[model samples]
Target chain A: MSASLRKFIITRILLTIPMVLILITLVFIIMRILPGDPIRSQLGPRVTEAQADVLRERLGLNRPLIVQYGDFLVEMITFDFGNALTQGERPIKDELAEKLPATIELSIPAVIFMAVLGVWSGAYAAKNRKKPVDYIFRLLSIAVYSIPIFVMGLLFQILFSVRLPVFPLAGRMDTVMLVSFDSPTNFYVIDAIITGNWPALGSALAHLALPAFTLGLALTGVFVRLTRVNMIEMLQSDFITAGRARGIPERRLVYKHALRNTFIPILTLIGLQFAALMAGAVLTETTFSWPGIGRYLVERIELRDYTAVQSTIGVFAMFVAGISLIMDILYAFIDPRIRY
Target chain B: MNDTSPLVQIRDLSVTYKTRLGDTSAVDKVSFDIRHGEILGLVGESGCGKSTLGKALLRMIMPPGRISAGQILFNGEDILTFDDKRLRDYRGRQASMIFQDPMTSLNPVQTVEQHLVEAIQVHEAQTQTPDATGRIKTLLERLGIMQSRLASYPHQLSGGMRQRVMIGLGLVLNAGLIIADEATTSLDVIVEAKLVDQLREIRDEFGVSILAITHNIALVAEMADRVAVMYAGNLVELGEVSRIFDRPLHPYTQGLLASVPTTEINERKELYKMPGEPPNLARPPSGCRFHPRCPAAMSICSRHRPGLNEAAPGHWVHCWLYQDHPEKEEKTLKVAA
Candidate 1:
């Protein structure tokens, strides 16, 4: 590596610190300002005011605002998001560790599907611009983009589940097959494959298919449009013309020469969309009854679990920040034009 | 030099661009031949279709720009008839082009090594030579580019170095002919000189034919053995460089020569400027496209389009001034009647 690249990496990493801080701080402030009483909401109206006060004291909610804020920062720094206020004081860390990977499992396949299908169709459309096939793809992408994810999920459920009876309608796996595999990573699909539990793997994938497809299809339009536009621009570039003059095959010219140049912008979009996917997962997960962090977040928000909400949003902010950093590093690796 | 059998023969070639407005004849019935082991400098003002003609030789014209009528015979085979596969094989192996802008011509994401290796591997995929790197090293060295620059991306190199790399790419296949379309137009004076010297050396050393397209007459005078002057999509003059410089037959050629600022004249003389812009190709002038702007235009010049006729030994011009016409008076009387 060059000195400039080293400097660039250092700068990107340093910039993330303030970005992550601001995100978490905003979440902290928003949780406080929102109309909610975690202790009362959890204890119910029948509980005595005295009992509520004792519960608040135990959970550090009785402390002064400054002391609580400082403690929250310190605990966050230490990666110890203390017990949930609504879930019988279960540690938020443990809950997240169990749920986050399930969310990732859903997101990974969805993102892969989005990228592959999106880029392929986009390139095809660009290559066949002004043709009937291109027109059809354009219209379909627009339709997919306009529809809401939950609506699409519900519709897909009806068409592929109720009507055709092909896939499981909801949840992470069949209840009967859930205990058959050892989930070493808490990501049932990978764990199922690792333990040679093919039935569990099939069950997990079948349950995941509709929701992931719904999420993937929802975001696929953006990639398709982005890649199509970028690919067209790159194909018109002089380098692509030069590549053609060099006798490179048309396919290689499109994919390697034109598409490779389009990657930096496409990668940027993917990074942003990945963050958006995590946010969208809330709707998808809720609709499907999938036991993921998104569903956990919605449940906590409903029950007025302030600490759980804060910790979950904090984790999301960190994930987004980390992804942006990784993308920056990747840009440096792929295009030598970028430097510190 | 095998002058009898020209390496590439372009016969009555015309290229038209299908714009929304209408069809514009960018290149109109242009014909010329490039001899083996010789430099043919194609000089004209911008938009004279010189660059289009160069691209036409390789059939590299992009869409909306089509060869409406032409026969580009490369070694007796009409290249215009070639399909995509054959065209791909023909380009970069038998002939290659060097673009004018080095900055935009090279892929920013690709290293110099990647560009050179791809140029080689695309044509010679069946060849099992691990010495691809060795060949690239020698080619760059010959072009005055250092071996260390191979790993560097195009953005890392200077403009002149990049131009050299472009030339290196053109030469990597050991092609029989190279069409340099204003290849040195973007370089500085000194860099241009160096590159022109390198082109000459490559021609002499490798016996590669070159068709240098440019607007610079002085560079052509220095480098090209023969020159073809184009005007408004027509080949106005073709002759030995020395003869064309000494006794220019066409009025446009004379104007071009007189307009060039030479150090021989110590006193400052007013630069001779051509009066009008090139005619729109959609509706070109009635006869000679240059007649409207020509200093020596005649009534017949507007009515009759002059064909390229030999004015001297191995010299051709498309102007009526050189034609002996006994029928001129009779034709004029007939037009009046």
Candidate 2:
């Protein structure tokens, strides 16, 4: 990479620190103001005030506000959430390491599916313009985009899992495969492959199918519409006309030349839609019983585990910042005019 | 092909656009011939269909606008009837175009060398050796872009350099006819002058015919061996440049030339500006399209359309004033009598 790109990356990473910090701080404040005390919520009313006070002191809830805030920040920096006050008093970080990877694994294939299928179909539709294929794609995109993700996940489960038995209804993998293979990375697909166990890999992928598809298919419409509009506008550009004048095959003009130019804006949209994808993941993980961060976050929120909630949000903020940074660096590589 | 025979004969070609109002005929029954090795300047005001006519030669007009009639015969082959396979072989290999606004003509992300090489490989990719850069390097050098700049993207190059790269793209295919549609309209006068000289050198050295289309009358005079003037989708006057300059027959042609600012230094005289805009092509005048704007419009000009007549041996004019209509004249005389 050039010196300028290296400098851009460094500055971009530096800027994310405060962004994540602010997001975490807001969560901390909201959790405090929300209508319930953590200790009261976790312990029963049968427990006396003296017993509650002792547990509060143990959990550092009795400390001064500024001191508690300082300790919270320090703990966030170290990524050590001590222990969950509710969920069996499990260590928050230990639980997080497993759940975060599952969310990322589901999201990786979901993103790839949305980008590839959406971009390709959009370009195809633009090339066909007023034809029947174009109109069909236009209608299909609207139809696909309007259906809520949770509804789609339920539908997929009924049609593919319950009725046809083509896939597992929920979760990341079957218990049989989970116990058979040693999941070192907590990513079943990776562990299955490394173990050279093809059946385990197949089972893991089969279990992943419904949730990933529902998650990905819900977002494909946005990419399709974006790529379609951009491709149509790009096709009218002078370079495309010039390319046609040179007798380039219409296939190459629409798919290769015009599509490449449209990607800078598409990359920006991809980065923005990532947050929406994560929001959908919460519903997806709940409907499918996938053991991911979205489900974990929901469980913690229900239990009013304040420490777990804010830490979970902090990790999300970091991931979002990292993705946006990657997108900016990608823009510099795609468009030379943006190198500065 | 014989030198005397026209290289490309455009016979009664028309291009129309389907608007909500009606079909707008941009190029109307236009017929002309570009001879081998001749630089024909096609001059007109904006929206007068000069660029449309240029694109028609290459069949580059997009949808909603299409060739409604006429045949384009290139080297005796009618390009209008060519299938996808033949059309691909014909473009860039036989004829190509250099568009206006070089800034937008080349892909922004693509390098200069990549533009030229793609034009060649589209038709002849199999025969292309690894050293395809051999021809590309030589062409860039001739266009005044250095070998080092070959890897540079369009944004890195200056405006003049970009235009030259466009020119190189057109020439790299060794095409016989180059339709330069206002190719230098965006350039500064100095760069335009240099490209003009290089274009002339290009014609003389390569023996390639050119249709230099622009609104700049002065540039047309400087470079065109023959000149064709279009007014409101009508080819009003066409002849040798010297003849048209010395004695323009059509009133619209005369009006166009008189509007050009010369270095004569006439005392405090304002330049002659034409009276009306080019008509809305969808609903042009009933007869001659130029009648509303013509300085010497006759009473019959609105009622009767005039054909392009050979007023002199090698000069053509489309006006009732020059082409005598004895029968129409008698009727007009009786009205006066």
- Largest lDDT belongs to which candidate? 1
* Best prediction by TM-score: 2
Regions more than 4 Å wrong, model 1 = A1-10, A45-58, B1-3, B325-337
The superposed Cα distance between candidate 2 and the true structure at residue A186, in angstroms, equals 0.4
- Report the lDDT tens digits of candidate 1 across residue range A1-340: 8797788778877888788788878877877788867887888889988998999998889988888778778878899998898977799999999999989989989999999999999998888888999889999999999999899999999999999999998999988777555787999988888888888988998998998998899999988999999898889899888878878888998888888888899899989997989988998999899899999999998877878988898888888878887887888667778765
State every prediction's TM-score relative to the real structure: 0.95, 0.96
Tens digits of lDDT, candidate 2, B110-222: 88877877888888877474466888888777777899998899989888888888778878888999999999889999999999998999999888999999999999999
Instruction: Name the best candidate (by DockQ).
Output: 2
lDDT of 1 by residue, B1-337 (tens): 3557999999999999998779999999999899999999999999999999988887888788999997999988999889999999998888888898999999999999999998888888864445788888888877788889999999999888998888788889988899999999899999899889989999998889999999999999999999999998999999999999988888888888878887868776787787888898888999889989886777778888898999998899998877856544322211100
For candidate 1, the C-alpha RMSD (Å) to the true structure equals 3.3
Chain B TM-score of candidate 2 stands at 0.94
Each model's lDDT comes to 0.88, 0.87
